[model samples]
Target: MNEHITEIVIFTALFLLVSGMGFVAARWRRADNLASLNEWGLGGRNFGSWITWFLVGGDLYTAYTFVAVPALLFGAGATGFFAVPYTVITYPLVMLVLIRLWSVSHVHGLVTPADFVRVRFGSPTLALLVAITGIVATMPYIALQLIGIEAVLKTMGVTGDLPLIIAFAILAAYTYQSGLRAPALIAFVKDILIYIVILVAVIYIPARLGGFGSIFDAADAKFAKTPAPGDGTLLNANNQLQYITLALGSAMALFLYPHSVTGVLASRSRDVIKRNMSALPAYSLLLGLIALLGYMAIAAGITPIGTDVNTVVPQLFDQMFPDWFTGVAFAAIGIGALVPAAIMSIAAANLFTRNIYKEYLRRDATDAQEARVSKLTSLVVKVGAVLCILLIDPQFSIDLQLIGGVIILQTLPSVALGLFTRWFHRVGLIAGWTAGMTAGMVLLYNIANPANNHAHFGGSAFPLSKLGFDTPMTVYAGFLALIVNLAVAALATVLARRLGSSEGVDGTSPRDYTADAGDPEVKDDLEVAGST
Candidate 1:
C-alpha cells in the first residue's frame, strides 16, 4: 500500500472531486422545482446537443467499454469486436425510431418506456410487464458498472468490499441529491478523461511495443495455442455466427434499456437526439481502439488478476504507465462506472415509480410524489446492484450485460415497435414476453462454459449442435430468443383477433409521434427551451 500510495491518492482525490461535482450539479441548471419527475429524473428535459452528446456517450460507452470490452478481447480475441458493430448499427437503427419515441414522450408527458406502453395500448398490465422487464434487466447492468470499478480497485491492490461500499454510498448520495443532473454534469469530466486515457493508450502503448503489427502478432500467437475454436485474433467458422448475432442483438437491445432512453429523453428536442445519434458512432472508433488494448496486453505480457479478465485493461495500464498517469487511467474507469451506474439506477427507479407505484399503489400520485418515490427507488436499486456484485459474480462482466440484453429485448414488441405500430394486441404482448423470457432463461441456463467450469448461465453463445445440427457453429442466444418473441407475439395476435377479444384503446394520436419542440399540441409543461 505504501509503494502504491501515489496512485491511490490521485485516484481517491479525483473520485472525491467528481462526487463534489455531482453534488453541485443540483444547481447546474437550477430548475424552478426539483420535485417533479420531469425535473429530477430527466434533467428538465432541456439538455442541448453537446450536453446530450457527452451524457449519452458517457452512459452507453461505460465501464463495459473501458473494462469489460477489453477484458473480453483479452480473454477471447476477435469475438470481442462484436461491440464495434453493436455501436455502429445502434445509432442508425434507433435514429429512425428514437425520434418518434421522443416526440410521443414529449407530447404525452411520458417518463419511461413503460409509460408509453400504458398510453399506446391502453393496457396497464402490459405496461406493468414492460416496467418489470426494464427494472429486472437494468439491475445486472448496474452491477456490471460496479464490477468495472472493482476491476480497477483490484488492480490497485484494494481488496474486499469496504471501498466498493464507500463508492456505492457516494454514488447514491449525490445521485439522490442531483438526480439526472448529477450524471449529466459529471459526464463532461468522465468523457474528457476517457478520451485522454484512450488516445494516449492507443498512440503511446503501440509505439512502446514496436507497433500494431507486434500487438496482433502477439495476440495471434497467444490464441493459436488455445484449444477453443473461437479463440483467435480473427474470426473462425464456428464462432462467426455468434459474432454477428451478438452484435446485432446487442444493437437492438441497447437503446431499449431504460438508462439509454433516459439519456435520449433528457435531450431538449428530437433534433438534439438526431444530432447525437448521428455523431455518437464516432465513439465506436474509440471502442475499436480500446478493444485493441487486449492484444496490446498480450504483447506486453500483462495477465489478469486471478481469473477475472475484467482486470486486464487496468492491469495493462499499471504495468505499462507511470504510477501517476496510471492513476488517471484508473480514475477514468472508476468514474466511468459512476456515471452509468447513476443513470441506470435512476432509469430503473423511474420505471418503478411511474409505471408501478403511480399506476397501482396510488392513482393520484402527483409529480412530487412520483419524484420522491423515484429517488427512494433509485437508492433501493443501487442496493440491489451491490448485492448482485456480492453474490452472483459472473464469469465475465460482459455476460451480466448480455443477460440484460436478452431480457430487455422481450420488450421490443411493446416499446420500440409500439412507438409506430400497435398491431400487437396487449394480451399477445404479455404472452410473447412470457415466452421470450422463459426461452431466454432456459437457453442461458443450458450454455455451459468449459473455461471456468461454469455449468450454467455461462454466457450468451448457444451452440447449434445442441439443436441436432451437424456443424460446429454457435449463435447468440438473445437473437434467437428475440426471434421466438416476435413469432409468438404474431401468432398470439392472430389468435386474439380470431377469438374476438377486446381490442384495447389507443390513447395517442398520429401527431404525437411527429411533433417537434414548441409545437402547440405538444405539452409545454416541461421546460426545455432555454437550457440548450
Candidate 2:
C-alpha cells in the first residue's frame, strides 16, 4: 500500500474529478426539467451525432469489456478474439434496425425497449416479461462494471468492498440528480482516457516487450509449451464452433440490451442513429487493440494478482509503465465502469417505472411521477448490482455479460423481430420467452468449468457431447436458446392462428417506424396519438 502511493494518488485524483463532473452534468445539457422519462432516462432525446457517439460508445464498450476481454484472451488464447468480431458484426447488422427503433421511439416518446414492445404488441404481460428480463439481465452487467473497478483496486492493493461502495455511492448521487445527462457528460472524458491508455499500451508496451513481432513470438512460444486444446495462437475444430456461435450470438444480443436501447432512444433522430451505426464500428477497431493487450500481458509475463485473470492487464500496466501512468490507466478502467453502470441502472429503472410501475402499480402515473419513480428505482437497481457482486460471486467475470446475453436474447423475437414483423402472436411471444428463458437457465446450469472448479453456471459454451454427440463441438448456449425461442414462437403462432386466437392489436402503425422527430409525418402522428 505504501509503495503504491503514486498510483493511488493519480487514480484517486482522476476518479474524484470524474465524480465531480458527474455532479455537474445536470447543467451540461441544461434540460428544462428532468421529471419525465423522456428527459431523465433518455437525456432529453436531442443529442447530436458527436454526443451520441461518445455516449453510445461509452455505453457499449464498457469497463467489464476493458478488463474481461483481455482476461479471456490471456486465459483462453485466440478464442478471446471473438469479442472483436462480434463487435464488428453488431454495428452493420443492427444499424438499419436501430434506425427504425430510434424513429419509433422518438415518435412515441418510448423510454425503454420494453416500452416499444408494449406499444408494438399491445400486451402488458409481454412488456412485463421484457422489463423483468432487462432488469435481471442488466443487474449482473452492472455488477461486472463494479467488478472491473474491483479488479483495478485489488491490483493497487486496495481491498475490501468499502471503496467500491463509496464509488457507486457517488455514482448513484449524481445519476440521481442529473439522470442520463450525467453519463452522457462524463463519457467524453472516459473515452478519451481509454483511448489514451489503449493507444499508449499498444504502442509503448509492445516496444518494451521488444516489438509486436517479439510479443507475438513470445505468446506463440508460451502457448506452444503448454499446448492444450484451444490454448494457442490458432483455433481448433472444438473451440472454433464455440467462437463462431459466441460471436454471432453476442452480436445479435448487443443492441437488444436495455442500456443499448436506451442509448439509441436518446438520439434526436433517425439520421443520427444511421450516422452513428456507420461510425460506431470505429470502436470495434479500438476493441481489436484492447484484445491485443492480453497477448502483450502474456509476452510481458504479467501474472494476475490472484486467480482472477481480470487483473493481468492492470498488473501489466503497473509493471510496464511508471506508477503515475499506471495510475492513469487504472483511472481509465475505473471511470469506464461508472459510465456504463449509470446507463444500465437508468435503463433498468426506466423499464420498471414505465412498463411495471405505470402499467401495474399506477395506471394514472404522471410523467413527473414516472420520472421520480425511475430515479428512485435506479438507486435500487444499483443496490441490486452491488448485491450481485457480493453474493453471486461469479468465478469468471465474463460470465456476467454472457449470462445477461442469454437472458436478454429471449426477448429477440418480441423486441428485435417484432420491430419488423408482427407475425408472432403475443401468446406465442410469451410462450417463446418462457421456453427460451427456461432452456437458457437449464443449459447454463449444465455447463461445468473444471478449471474454475465450479459445478454449475460455469460459462456459456455448451458442449455438443452433452447432447450425446461423439464430436467435441460446442455452441453458445444463448444462440441455441435463441433457436429454441424462435422455433417455439413460430410453431405456437401457427397453432394460435389455426385455433382462431386473437392476435393483439399493435398500437403502433407502420408509419410510426419511419417517423423521425421534426418530420411532417411525425407531428401529425403524435397529434393523432396524443403522446408527444
lDDT of each: 0.89, 0.87
Expressed as tens digits, the lDDT of each residue in 1-532 for candidate 1 is 3667778999999999999999999999898888888889999888999999999999999985788788788889989989998899999988987889999988878889999999899999999999999998898888888888998898999899999999999999999999999999999999999999999999999999999998999999999898887788889889999999999889889989999999999998888989888888878999999999989999999988888888899999998899999999999989999999999999999999988998899988877888899999999999988877887755443566667889999899899889889899888888898999999988998999988787987888999899899988999998888889889999999999999999789989998999998898676654432211
Q: How displaced is residue 35 in candidate 1, in Å?
A: 0.1
- Once superposed on the true structure, which residue ranges of model 1 sit more than 4 Å away at CA? 392-400, 525-532
Clashes of each: 0, 0
lDDT of 2 by residue, 1-532 (tens): 3888999999999999999998898888776677777778888777899999999999999998998899888888898999988998898877867778877776676778888899898899999999999987888888899989999999899998899899999999999999999999999999999999999888898888899998889888888887467688788889889999999989988888999999988887778888988899889999999999999999988898868898998989989899999999999999999999999999999989988999999999877888899999999988888877877765543566667889898999998898899999998999988899889988998998887776988888899999899989889999889989999999998999899998877888888888877786554322322352
Q: Give candidate 2 misplaced runs (Cα > 4 Å).
A: 392-400, 523-532
Candidate 1, TM-score vs. the true structure?
A: 0.97
Q: Candidate 1: give its CA RMSD in angstroms.
A: 2.1
Task: Estimate the lDDT of model 1.
Answer: 0.89
